[model samples]
Target: MTITRGRFGHYKLLKNTKRLSPHVPDIHVYSESVLTSLLNNLQPLFIRPLLGPELIRIIKSGETYNLVVNDNEPIVTDRKSIVPCLIKQLHPKKTYIIQVNPTISYTPCRTFYTLQRKREGANWKTVHKTVQDTECTPRYMNFLIHWKLNRFLLAVAGKLGDAFVGCHTMVLEIGYAEGAFFLYDTILHERNSKWSQYQSFIRSRTIRPFMPHTDLCTKSTLKAFLRNYGKAIIKPAVGQQGKGIVKITIMPSGDFEVQKRNNLSTYKTFDALFQSIHSLHLSREDYIIQYYIALGIVDGCPFDVRVITQFDEEYGWIATGKLVKVAAPGYFITNRAQKLLAVEEVLSVPDSHIEQVCINGSIALSAQLNNLSIIGFDIGVEEGGKVWVIEANHVPSIAMFHNFGNNEMHTKITQFIGKRRRSLSENRKEEG
Candidate 1:
């Protein structure tokens, strides 16, 4: 493998790598024609500088493009004027490239991280670093270990080190999108502290069996799902707090009933139902169509279990906490729970079984991704006592444990995070 100098060089190297070629998104040097063509083809595309971390996103909507710059509000621009808007927003005399955004049904809540490793005597050890992203600023927070992905990354790092023998360290920007991993940029001769967020899709091949049937929402997909299951849950691909979730059920009269929160609307035909959902939710952001699980109900309200699992190098995966969140009155989403109870009280499944399933799912994710230390599993227990993983939260809320009277698990999570922080500090001292 050859050491790639700039973004283009990195792309070329990644393209040539046998293991990484298929994951690479279509990219091109910036030109007005290229931009026009990409805007025509890809829904949301990235335009980034060749050398810096600054980025621009152009998303197509109706007849205009929503031009966004790095987490900012999108400014609407027409097709002919998008290049000029980029010129005004970007710095002069810098080269930029356009990349197709590769995310489909990305998780709503996720933490950003950077992985760093040092090579010595044919072995590589991670230089543990933790970065906490805040509302206004992004800084290094944590080091997560994905055993298999780590090995592959380190192999690439070793090749880079061999190619640039004199260069001590290089920072590579790797991303996961649509199930495969891609290396998009590399910073050499210096440490690039720029923060890049990577999206982790839980529907990786290994973890799919434990999850319910899920697919990106489209007319055909939604129709197929509804046809097969007679019901579907349409949720934002990137959302939290149980927001923007709509349930559509096929009535006995062959009508579609769309329910959002407390309100319900009826449509006569599948096309009418699809059109209503598309305008109300799908057109704004990405959404997924899922087979609606009829969760076990407590006093007529459906409830789901939240199981917290953490990874430990010494003892393997640990299931730290379990609690049942019953949906509020008139609302099916459990985020606004009317009551929380112990898991064993509500469901027939054994505690041991739920713990094993959650831990196994966590491990399976780690095999495919450089995943987080902690993952939260939203599990639905059916009336028949079957368990289905509804969703996996990468940044699962920890404070909720206290509300469920699980102080022991909350403290354990706090200690676990503190230990990681201390390890990160020790690694930094050694590097210094």
Candidate 2:
């Protein structure tokens, strides 16, 4: 095969083609089988055993002639040596060679925030900070193969969902799903959906709206809402990350009190609060006023519980993880701005009671979200054990489970995808 180089200065060799180049390197030995063998042999040498005899044999064999594997792809050993060799063997006008590198970086790609603890001789010292920067470049072809294999595995697992759903009792999920998963969980009653329908369903079945927060917009409506709950929270309905949330309380002396997150002081009247809120440019429709739940404190910081629901192959609707999110100092919402602590560590009240409340609240929330499929229910409990529904998140972040060393949630997700793939495949097979 003798061909001119492309604009990128690279020439690709077709199948079973012999190079007839005089003063250029022949680039035709890069095959998928060869790349797979190279990756399989190279990956296991990180611990103890180094390269095996077979790899050594492959390396020594001059059959590879002037080809060298860097990272994993085959490249011309030396442009001078290989070019001269090819030129002498087969005469060609010119040649172009493509280079590939494959190496996994030991460091993470993104700047991840982590807490570090140190011990001075024996006791622990204050946490310090660190930064890590490393680039990992995996062999492109091999990476694609691994990714496809994982996808295939997920497809196979998803087909077995029916069996799993029949056997499992509870399902906990913490991820985003568009519509299919929601339909499946709701129709099958397999997992909590985390949608408003769950709340409506629970309210219809139980005859009580769970944590019905007042919707006060006007001054008169705000006064009425305040009179009902004594303490109310003004929040944006479509808001997130705890922004635009204000806590309001009515003083016994007939004056109004207001507190804003991250603020050091409280306001005594609506005028003072409205001035602050107005400065934020909040529109009437951009905010919602609700009864505030005095979530119990953990280490002097208020915290809330997040109960995740998912559908498993063996279990229908299961509570996967119970996480206690403690708000940051002077913050109102228990989000990433807050510290993630174990439920046991953050539960300030009695263990038995807290557990019961969490279980009951989770079950109720799950049953409500069941109509939706994947859901995260945030529940707040007061010091006196008054439990209230904070909110429901349809698309909650799953990164927390990655921090906790439990990837079962990911497995379930893969399984869900697999089942859907299998179902589609079967339908196509039937149609065909």
Best by lDDT: 1
lDDT computed for candidate 2: 0.42
lDDT per residue, candidate 1, 1-432, as tens digits? 455465666666666667655655666888888887787674468787776556677877789888977545689988889988987877678777788756455421222223333222344333322211122122222333245446655666565555654333344455543344555445543211111111122324544455777655656667778889999998865677888889999999999998898788899997677767766676555466778999888989999999988876667789888889999988877888999888778877899888887887777555533535888889898999888888777788987887657388788877877876777789899999
Query: In candidate 2, which residue ranges exceed 4 Å CA deviation?
Result: 1-202, 206-212, 251-257, 264-268, 271-284, 312-314, 348-371, 405-432
Give lDDT tens digits, candidate 2, residues 1-432. 232222111112211122211111223233334333443332211100011100111121233332422122334343235434333322143322221221222311211111111111122111111111122222233555445433422322222222232211111111111211100010111222222223333344342334655432334445567767887777654555666677777778766666667664456776565555444423322344566777788777888887665544455545555677888887766774456766667565554543444345444554433333445667787887666667666566656755654666556654654764676688899999
* C-alpha lDDT of residue 245 in model 2: 74
Q: For model 1, what is the C-alpha lDDT against the true structure?
A: 0.67
Native-to-model Cα distance after best TM-score fit, residue 321 in candidate 2, in Å: 2.0
- Candidate 2 Cα RMSD (Å): 24.3
TM-score, predicted candidate 2 vs. hidden true structure: 0.44
Locate the minimum summed-lDDT window of 10 residues in model 2.
47-56
